[model samples]
Target chain A: MDMLEQYLPFFTKLTPQQQAVLSQNTTRHTAKKGEIVHNGSLDCIGILILVRGQFRVFTLSEEGREITLYRLWERDICLLSASCMLNSIQFDVSVEAKKETEYWKIPASVYRKVMQQAAPMANYTGELLAARFSDVMWLMDQILYKRMDSRLAAFLLEESQLEGGRELKMTHEAIARHLGSAREVVTRMLKYFQSEGLVALSRGSVTISDETGLRKLAEESLR
Target chain B: MDMLEQYLPFFTKLTPQQQAVLSQNTTRHTAKKGEIVHNGSLDCIGILILVRGQFRVFTLSEEGREITLYRLWERDICLLSASCMLNSIQFDVSVEAKKETEYWKIPASVYRKVMQQAAPMANYTGELLAARFSDVMWLMDQILYKRMDSRLAAFLLEESQLEGGRELKMTHEAIARHLGSAREVVTRMLKYFQSEGLVALSRGSVTISDETGLRKLAEESLR
Candidate 1:
């Protein structure tokens, strides 16, 4: 499929003239893993649609701790990154390439213009925003109500599923960053998990030695 | 100003036919305080715009603990309540009238149709969704990064401002529910605050005796 056809199916709903306008405006871009694609821009440079690879969208604290809000993978449309363009949304989130990522950057002006003219695009945008808001609500529930051990177990299980492997090539510090926790806290918890024979940690990687144990731990309700 | 003229200027941007559709489809609603307005269906009821009084929108854990996501005051548009009708947005949010409130409820189907046709309405909808998402992100930051004492103090200050008084007519359980914590935890913290001369507790209310002290403590950065 062509760029417009692949990333935005609503492209077909647009008139040929609008389609030509979109094609004329958008640029295809690629970045290597670990690159800071958007350095916490209040003024969004562009709206990104991940064509392949992964991107981690996160918020930062004054003390420099980071928490991953959500991740964008293939075919995901990013709206929060362009905070200024979207009136009433005041986001200070930064985006980083979690893997070698390719995406289409739609200039905020063009995206807004098309959305104004195309009902399909407008409806799709609303759906994307609502979905993102729901994700944040779910995270709030987890952090406020769930226990740290259970959250960690859940994270590990999710990471294993995402990677499709028993071994997770990630450091404790990385895990702490993702969970918005202290490195010492994550280290202590990982050591405890190791003692329980649920996971084996070596250097910067964790191997799921007992999936059932981890699953049970994840499901454990703590008050 | 009339309903559309007063609450939504976007109505003017629509054609006469579109305005008629909106007028024909919307209902003016009033509810007493403490009413459970929206029970959080996967299928949304309508798009609500608060014209008078206050409404609290919150999420409840399986354990029944509730943490407020945000509040809707006059002129606030509540899109989250109509989750299912908006494709891809799956929200489980319950809304209650915090005070005797009056609002305009636009039928979900009508709102969606109008949004699909009117660029101004679509743009406004995007703005509302983006704004709500930002609020959720801020809440997540507070829960993960800030200490309980600071969070509680901030909440009290905000409540005082909202109620226009130094004394808050709320119970420990009420505060705990807002913070998504146990009542005992809230009671302990309130006692601690009382011991520090930050507040005075009565039968069912908390009076801020030392606003400066509470503000200072709230501003204290925790490592």
Candidate 2:
């Protein structure tokens, strides 16, 4: 499948003609590691489909603390900010390349026009929005019902699955920030996991050695 | 302006023919206080317009906890749960009347047909979905960043505004559940607020004496 086909689920169903229009209209851009794809002020719409590499979606607090809400990799679309394009508001979150990345930036106007003329496009948008709504609901549930340690464990599990490997290119401090906890707390947990032989942690990376053990820990903590 | 007129922003851009079809094809129902409009198994679509009174949009967890995610009042529509109809899945949440409420329940087929034939309906659904997305984001922000006290205070202020009065009808236990905290915590916070001259509590109601003070407290707690 092509790039558009890979990212098709992120959008509404489209006819061949509408798909061709989108394919022709979408522009691919490359960003080096740490480069910002769209800052908080850019007023653009349509989905940002990560075709290659990884990116971090985050917002800064008033005290300059960065809150990492999500991490995106290949085939994932930034629907959170992309949906905002319909309202003409400046982007609320910034997208920065976690590594050298290539993505397609489609225009909101083109997408809207095609959606108006295509049944599949409208259905696709409905499905995408519904999925996003479910995601936000799950995140809310995690924040409300889970403890910091459980949240951290779940994040680790999610990251491991996303990377399709035991190795994670994330520091303890980074994980702490994502879980909204202190670095020291994360360090203690990591030490505990390391002692149990569940994970191996080095200076800037972690590798899960006992997936079943980690999952069991998460379940027990949740209970 | 009529009740439907408040929704004109969504459909104003559509052609007259489309507006006529939407206006004629829509169905309206009145729900008495505490009545359920849609339950977990109901599959209905179209926009639910709150023409009068109020409704509570909530979900029940597996543990039997009732989580009130949103309160829908006059002129507001329940755009989030419209997904169940589109996806043909069980409703993720249920809508119940907080007071005797009247609403328009447009069928999904009618809505889709209107969107195809009418520019206004299409515009309305798009704009409504965008607003719902923002509302979810704001709720997520509150859940993730705000403390229990702050969340409770914000909830109180919001409830006061929704009721259009200084007195709120909700009980302390209900408020505690909404904040996802213990009832003891809510009682303690209420006492503190009372000592601070921010609120006066009774058997099943809370009356705000110092709205400005409560807002200040919430703001401080958020920081």
lDDT of 2 by residue, A39-67 (tens): 66464445788889987877655455544
Note the B-chain TM-score for every model.
Answer: 0.94, 0.80
Predicted candidate 2 versus true structure: per-residue lDDT over B1-223, tens digit per residue? 2345565565665566766766777788888999987775464555688888988877665455666776777888776546644562223677889889988876666667766554445555655666665565666566555666677788889888877999998888888777766678889989988888989988899999998888987897556
**How much is B189 displaced in model 1, in angstroms?**
1.6
Segments of candidate 2 deviating more than 4 angstroms: A1-25, A41-46, A63-73, A80-84, A88-91, A109-119, A146-223, B1-25, B41-46, B88-91, B113-120, B221-223
Q: What are the per-residue Cα lDDT tens digits for candidate 1 across A1-223? A: 2578777878888889888888898898999999988878545777898989988888888789876777888999887666667777766888888889998888988888888888788778887888887767655665676566788998999999999999999999999999887787688678767755689999999999999988976885343
Best lDDT goes to which candidate? 1
True contacts kept of each: 0.79, 0.12
Give the best candidate by TM-score: 1
Error of 2 at A85 (Å): 2.4
Task: Give one clash count per candidate, in the order shown.
Answer: 0, 6
Error of 1 at A94 (Å): 1.4
Q: Just chain B of model 1: what TM-score?
A: 0.94
Q: Cα deviation in Å at residue B214, candidate 2? A: 1.4
